[model samples]
Target chain A: MPLLEIRNVTRRFGDFVAVDNISLSIESGEFFTLLGPSGCGKTTILRMIAGFDLPDAGQILLDGQDLAGTPPEKRPVRTVFQSYALFPHMTVAQNVAFPLKMARCSADETRQRLGEALEQVHLTDKAPAYPHELSGGQKQRVALARGLVNRPSILLLDEPLGALDAKLREEMQIELINLQRDVGVTFIFVTHAQVEALALSHRIAVMREGRVEQVDEPARLYAFPKSRFVADFIGHINLLDAQVLEATHGHLRLTIAGLGEMIAPPLAGAAPGGKGTFAIRPEQVRIGIHGEVTELKNHFPGEVTHFLYRGDVTVYKVRLANGMMIEALLPNSAPGGAELFKVGDPVRVGWRHDAGVFLHE
Target chain B: MSDEHANLSPAARLTKWLVSGPPFVFLLLFFVAPSIIMVVASFRYPGEFGGLAPVAAADPATLQGLTLETYRFFFSDFIYTEIFIKSFFVALATTVICLVMAYPLALLIARSPKKSRDLMVLLVILPFASNFLIRVYAWMILLGPQAALSQLVNGVLGAVGAGPVHLLFSPFAVLIAMVYVHLPFMVLPLYTNLEKHDPSLLDAAQDLGANAWRRFWHVTFPLSLPGIFSGSTLVFIPVLGMFAIPDILGGTGDMLIGNLIKEQFLGTRDWPFGSTLSIMLTLAVLLCVWLAARVGSTRGRYA
Candidate 1:
């Protein structure tokens, strides 16, 4: 059994349902992330788990015990808010010492725990400093220290790195991952940043419109998203409308309007001759001057309409004869590649058999 | 905006002053001048006929020969000193009571459900809309002997056969009146401060393992100190000089410094003593405000 189990939890604010009936289980010591856009109920779910919010319907179980009517203070779960809500009045030491003090720990124990907590965050030197004196990254570290000091069974983080700069956020993400490993505690993180979620989580639950669209390990979620929403949300995916022409022995033959017949790997539970959408990652499509199809299955003939010379790769907007536009990211290694993929240049776009996956439109 | 006024001259300054001079002069004449006159008169003795008679009519412009006799009189009398001490204590009590009551109410208002929060705030502020003197009078009716409250207590003390308990015309009445009158004054600032508090910070605290009480003591309370100071100062300063509520509910026997000042001025017909008492009251209020400001700054800075 998972350490924390949310069984059909539903939360509503008056007439508006913030979180629809949903359930998920978080395993022990796993860095689980709830990734979604704002108002997608990711934070609401985290709140429910932390006992800050009670579900209107269903139950939240911690360690196989029902957490019904348990106040946040009584719960074993702790949450780190987006703002890094450090006690502005208290010094870092006092702030870290608070939970232990609340738990009725002795003076020696409080001091020892506070020292360890501060040392974990590498903020022992600034223990006397107030929240205002600390930088954004430092404040977040302090918040981490305060949360971990209590040694809660599960630490809930609500966009812990959202307030940091890009560089700082990247740094903290690694630091947080390391911290989670060191503490060996179950961490349920909430964020709208897909990269952050994917990079940190042992498992990612991609949420949309008050429901969990897909929940899986980051690689699987990105590689084989079950829905168009999950696929589009995770990364940049070029969606193409297609009709499955044949289905035989775990292989699907789909005819796309702009790009003709592509024999792709079988999609689980999808019927042959059914209308579906296919998703291909931008980077997966190879753009070249040669129109001849290679060993790859899906090939499309198009004219490059616009070119974007990004530092790492040159992206081309290819316009097919059927008026459908497809994007391809090509490495900028060729000397004249910037000018080579000029406006109105005839180009061939091709991908492997497994590149395109059937998804709900 | 400054570029447009670059061509403006010193003459414009004079013109601006001239345009604003009437109200300034009018305020000086009515407000500032009388205050100075009161200070001057506080040093003078009562004349044979009554009212303020200049101690040194020969040098009408100055008060070089003024004595501390009025101040000495108030200090010498036990009644005046007792009343003065009682007023300070009561004001302090009122301030503490207000802080205790307002903090939770302010927090509730700040954190209440959005749909009902506004209406709840309006309800809290509704009592403030009522007439101040009328509310005190209403308290008098409720707390007076043979009043509803007195009868209720008497009913509770049935075994003793106490028909109607003596409830009003006491310090308790004075304290209740002061707290009731100034509770909103305390709550408004606290609410404003608490409302401005970014809630994400509280979540940050919880995530840190700080429990509910710890979060409040460390985070919430410290953040709201400025509001607490302002609210307490607002309540305490005025409460020291509050005469109307005490007069109506506290009865004539239990008088405060304000009542003492009023008695000196009108009843006893001693303008100098009244002026001295008023000056003392003003000094006390200024002292309270300064102390509050100093304490607030220290606490807020550390908090």
Candidate 2:
């Protein structure tokens, strides 16, 4: 049985539905993330799971026991809020020790666990410091320590790194991954940042408009998005409007207007002459000078209109002979590192037949 | 500091003084000078007619015609000291009652939706639109005999086999009026502080296994200490020296230090004794503030 199961939960505020009929099953000791934009019901689902809120219609079960009557204090779950939410008047030790204290743990046990939780977050030296005296990253560590001290079966984190700067966020992400690995706690993390969701979660549930769009492992979800929304939401992908020309056993031939026909990996139930989109990651396309032979059969001669230099890789926007724009990302790996293709340079772009996925509708 | 001031342009220097001059001069003239005069007046003897006697460098009244006679008389008797203790108790009771009544109201206003909070706060302050004395009079009427509230109370007492007792012109009436007049002071500061609190803290506490009452005791109440202190100070100080409420609604036994202080000057025409009492009240208020600060700091040190 799954460790936690949310069975068709719905939460509404007056006329507005904050979380509409969402169901999920979470395994033990897996980091799961509800990933979406703001107001997409991700945080609402997290709050319900933490028992701060009750679903209007659903049964949330933990260890196969229905959690309908359980209050937040009685539930064996904790949350690290986005704001850190450390009590301003409390020292770091007091903040971290709160959950243990609430559970009526023995004083000596609380002290032991408090020290262990602080050491886990690398915040041992900051035990005596008040929350206001700590930096943002320190405060975040304190919040994490507080959430972890009680050894809860599930820990909910609501965009805990969203307040951090980019560099600190990256550091925290690595720390969080290691922390989860060490503790082996079932972490139910909620975030709108796709990169963060990808880095920290074993499985990501993409949400849209109070519903789950897709739930899959990070790699699979990134490589094979099921809908236009998922393709646009997860990462940078060029969605070319096309129509299904013909469907073979393992491939579908698609036609882009003003461009030409192309082949994509097979899409189930892609009918002939049906409208769809060929979603391809920019890195999958190869951009090279014209007449430079490439392995890919699908080819287009174009001119580079613009390029964005992103340190590790440069993304070149190619204008095909038909005036259609397609993007190609090439690494800046050569010596004397700079963009190999400048703007207005003639180039050819191509991709393998199976490089992109064809999504109907 | 003088060097820093000297670096400023003439216009800047003049503008600096222009802003601070009025308040500085006002305090010097009205507050500081009157306090000094009162201290001096506390040492002088009362004239045969009224007010202080004429000052003389050497007179038979006592070396320099200014004696410590009023302060000596105050300490020689315990009746004046009893009024001080009674006034302290009344102020303390009023503060406790106001805090108990205002806390929930302030919390409700703070937790209410943003658009409605302004109207709730406005309602708190709306009572101040009427004259303070008129509002005290309104309480007197409510607690008066034959009034609906008094009749209902006495009716309950009658049913309980107890004799009907007076509600008006009693300590209860005076206390009710005091709480009524000063409730806004308690509510406003508390609301202001409670409103600024991040509600996410409570949510986090609840997630960490704190129940509703525990969340309040552990999070909300402690965070509002600044507002509580300020509100208590505002209510306690004004209620300590309040004379009109007791004069209008109080019985003979309901006398507070304020009534005694007033009688020294207005009834007995003893200016020196009045000054002496005012000085004592000032010292007592100072002591109360210091004691509150001490308690607050020590309590806050651990949490």
Candidate 3:
């Protein structure tokens, strides 16, 4: 059995359903993420698991025991809040030791566990300082220590790094991964940033409109998105409205509107007369001034409508002969840091036949 | 401060004075002058009939001495000292009772949804729109012998084998009136402070294994100490010098320092003795304020 199971949970506020009938089963020690935009019910699901909220319909089970009517205090789950809600009145050590004290642990045991918790977050030196005196990063560490002090089986992080600066967020992301590995606790992470979800989670559940669109490993979720929403939401991708001409032998021949025809990978549940979107990542297409090559099964002659120089790579938005715009990215790997292409330059963009995937909308 | 202001242009200085001068002159005239007169008057001897004697009387029979006679007279009697102690206890009791009654109400108003919190706060302040004395009078009718509350209370006492007791014109009535009159002073400050508290802190506490009561005791209460201190001071200071509540609702035995002070000024017309008593009350209030501030600061480090 899964360590935690949310069985057909539904939550409603007034007439609006914040979380529709959804269910998920998480295994022990897995770094699972619920990734979505705001109001996608990601936080609602997390709150339900932490026992801060209840599902109107369905059940939540922890270790195969139904957690109905259990208050947050009795649940073996802790949440690191978005604001890092450390007690302003307590010292770092006291904040970290509160759970142990609540459990009625002996003085020696609390002290030992408190010391270990603080040291785990590298906050041992800040034990005596009050929360207001600590920097934001230190306060976040104290919050983390306090949550982990009692050694809960599962930890829920509600956008814990959302408040940090970009550089510090990167550093803390690494620390969080290492800490999760060391503690071996099931981490249920929630984030709106796709990069954060991809970088941190062992498995990603891409959510949209109170529903999980896909749940898979990061590489698979990125390479083969199941729907246009998943492909558009996860990262930068160009989507084209296509007409499926034929389907046979695990290959679908689709004609993209104004970009000509190409053989796309098998589109599940697609008929020859059906309509769907052809999705390809920006990095998959090769952009240059060279004409069509035989190695490339799909090639288009286009003019560079615009170029975005993002230091390591430049994305060129090219308008094809039929006025369909396609985004292609090329790394700045050539010598001397000069931009190779500018607006109005004629460019040839091509990709292998298998590079693009067909989504059944 | 003068040196810093010297660098300003004439118009700047004029603007500065225009902003600060009114309150400065007002305090000087109304507060500083009266305090100086009272301090000087407290040292003078009383006239034979009532008012103070001449400042420099030549006749030996006339009372014109600048002496500590009132202070000496005050220390020479224990009754006056007893009134101060009784008044202190009443004020302390009122503060504790107000704190207890106001906390839950304040927390409720603070935790209420934002759209309705204004309506709730309006209800708390709505009672204050009426005359204060009229409110005290309203309490009188509620505690009157013929009132249902008194009858119910006396009935409960009678059933318990205790003799029926009067509710009005007693210390209990006086205390009840005092608390009712001063409750808004406690609730407003507490609500303001509690409203500023982040609701997430309580959730964090609960998530860390603290039950409802522990969350309140450990997180909510400690954070509200500032509100408690302000409310306590607001209720304690005014109740210390309050005369009308006791005079209206209390029995003759409920004479506090406020009654004693009032009697000196109005009944005996002993302005010098009244000044001395007023000075003593001032000193006592200052002491209490100093002690409260010290406690607030010492515990306010975390808050």
Residue lDDT tens for model 1, A1-361: 8999999989999887889989999999999999999999998998888777889999999989999977777788877878777767778787778778778899888888888889888999998898889999998998788888889999889898988899998999899999999999999999999999989999999888789998999999998989988988998888889888887776888888755788777876667668888888888888776644465667778999888888878889998768888888877785666666688888888888877688745
With a 3 Å backbone cut-off (N, CA, C), the pairs that clash in candidate 2 are none
Best by DockQ: 3
Put down candidate 2 lDDT per residue, A1-361, tens digits, no spaces.
Answer: 9999999999999998989899999999999999999999999998888887899998899999999899888889999999999998788998999888788999999989998999999989989988888888988889988999999999999999989999999999999999999999999999999999988889999999999999999999999999999998998898889999899898888898888988788877888989988899998987776444255767878999888888898888989888878888877895434547779888788888889888778
TM-score for every candidate vs. truth?
0.85, 0.93, 0.94
Query: Chain A TM-score for each candidate, in the given order?
Result: 0.96, 0.97, 0.97
Across B140-184, the per-residue lDDT of candidate 1 in tens digits comes to: 888877677887787888768756557788888989989998998
Summarize candidate 3's per-residue lDDT along B190-265 as a digit string, tens digits. Answer: 9999999999999999999999999999999999999999999999999999999999999989998898889988
**DockQ-based ranking:** 3, 2, 1
Consecutive 10-residue window with the lowest summed lDDT within model 3 chain A? A286-295
Give the root-mean-square deviation of each candidate in angstroms: 4.4, 2.7, 2.5
**Which should have the higher lDDT, number 1 or number 3?**
3
Clashes of each: 5, 0, 0
By lDDT: ranked, best first: 2, 3, 1
Candidate 3 Cα misplacement greater than 4 A, ranges:
A248-250, A267-271, A291-294, A335-338, B1-16, B58-63, B146-164
Candidate 2, B222-299: lDDT as tens digits: 888988999999999999999999999999998998998899888999999999999999999999999998878865
TM-score order of candidates, best first?
3, 2, 1
Residue B131's lDDT within candidate 2 is: 95
